[model samples]
Target: MPEIVYAYLDVNYWHPWKIFGSISSVKQLELCLPSSKEYPVGTVFHNLVYLMLCTCETEWLNLLLCLLRDSPKLKFLRFEQYHPIRPSEERPCWSEPSSVPECVVSSLETLEWVKYEGGEEEKEAVAFILRNARCLKKATISAASTDPVKKLEMLKELSFLSRCSGTCHLTFD
Candidate 1:
């Protein structure tokens, strides 16, 4: 798998590292993941530049942070919901990382979130990236809600957050 440069894995398997460990050299990847308690600590994606994740899990922030920490050369990050999520009794959990990721501080340039619900966890994850991505050139957030009132509310809330990149353009889609 060292020769693999791109991979799209939509498997139901929850152990993402087992899949990722085989293809550490991939430059672009798209995958659907369920949250796992343990992160891929030793794996480093030295050549990865673009990543797209399906936000179908309730607790995906940990995995996202872990990937950001490891993908030092990542430039484009995107999140999209591949399937409708049923309401769950538990809300998604999110906790700020102790240190900012190298990708967000230096290499990341573009961000896009589709089917973005204005949930606390979602907002925090998006805000964290926007606040810290110093090289970010654009951020496009497409709200999941169709109602105008809800969209406006989300717009107002997200618009107020300070961005690390002075020239970054933010858009609602």
Candidate 2:
């Protein structure tokens, strides 16, 4: 079977699990959903290079972590939960992992998180990624409609966190 370079899955919109079997090498996967329910992660896209995602439900973050934990080759990850017009509203929250995923500590090189609000869970996740991702080269976080004061506070806190990679650059937008 030939390796697949791209795959898009959205249970909320389409059921394409049948086609996934033939894909031996998917390099990019995107998931768009009102995803609060768990998706089976038995199939690991080990060759995946980029992952782009969106989740609209409250339980999305935990489910997300469970799903992506096995992708050791993932280099670029983008999580979209930012609301540009409404910063005061709650964004998706990630639970502190009992053990950090290998991707966060090894293969991942760049992380782009959109609509970050600097919430408690957000801080914990950010801190974990920054401190643990040994191979990480850059992290970009964009928060829309956020208060300047809060943004600065978030920046200061993140800046002080110890990152495993000395070359990693943290950027706020």
Candidate 3:
């Protein structure tokens, strides 16, 4: 009946048996995906402005990176986890002749992390995003806990990580 400008995809719910449309109009998306053995291929996002991704594991973040690669028009990215996982997940390791995704190299403008626990994998992901997202304007990282010492540590660590954007602004909360 009307154009859709926003979409939410949560795996914890029932979805239409068959759904398809001119989602070309969608500019924002909120996605909550659970950890699993299988990962979906291909996506419908195009010309998006913002995306908030919630997952239970760091492994799922690769999917987000790939999605962002495809959604070259995306501007802002947000990360949230439904559960705090062990700091065991490894950093992104490409197989061969690896290079940063074009979206990270050019399109991304801002990134924010909510409930960031400063896990190794999380830190690596943040560092990777910062180092590659050449056009990034700002990055905000909020820890799960409000402990002043821990927050300060995380802030120092993330702020110190080199970013490709000369004007990137980093803040912690």
- Local accuracy by lDDT, each model: 0.88, 0.71, 0.72
* lDDT by residue (tens digit), candidate 1, 82-156: 977768636677899999999999999999999998888888988899899999999999999999999999999
RMSD vs true structure, all candidates: 1.3, 3.5, 4.0
Give the lowest summed-lDDT range of ten residues in model 1.
83-92
Across 25-103, the per-residue lDDT of candidate 2 in tens digits comes to 7888776655434445576667877987664445457656864586778889887753232345466666677887777
- The TM-score of candidate 2 is 0.78
Off by over 4 Å in 1: none
Query: Which one is best on lDDT?
Result: 1
Best-to-worst order by lDDT is 1, 3, 2
In candidate 2, stretches whose alpha carbon ends up further than 4 angstroms from where it belongs are: 10-24, 82-93
Instruction: Evaluate residue 115 in candidate 2 and report its C-alpha lDDT on the 0 to 100 scale.
Output: 80
**Residue-wise C-alpha lDDT for candidate 3, range 1-173, written one tens digit per residue:** 13677887766433321232345457887777544234434544666788888856444666676567657688889988765555676544322216676677878898999998786768888888888888999999889978999988888888889988899999888
Q: TM-score for model 3?
A: 0.79
Best by TM-score: 1
lDDT score of model 3? 0.72
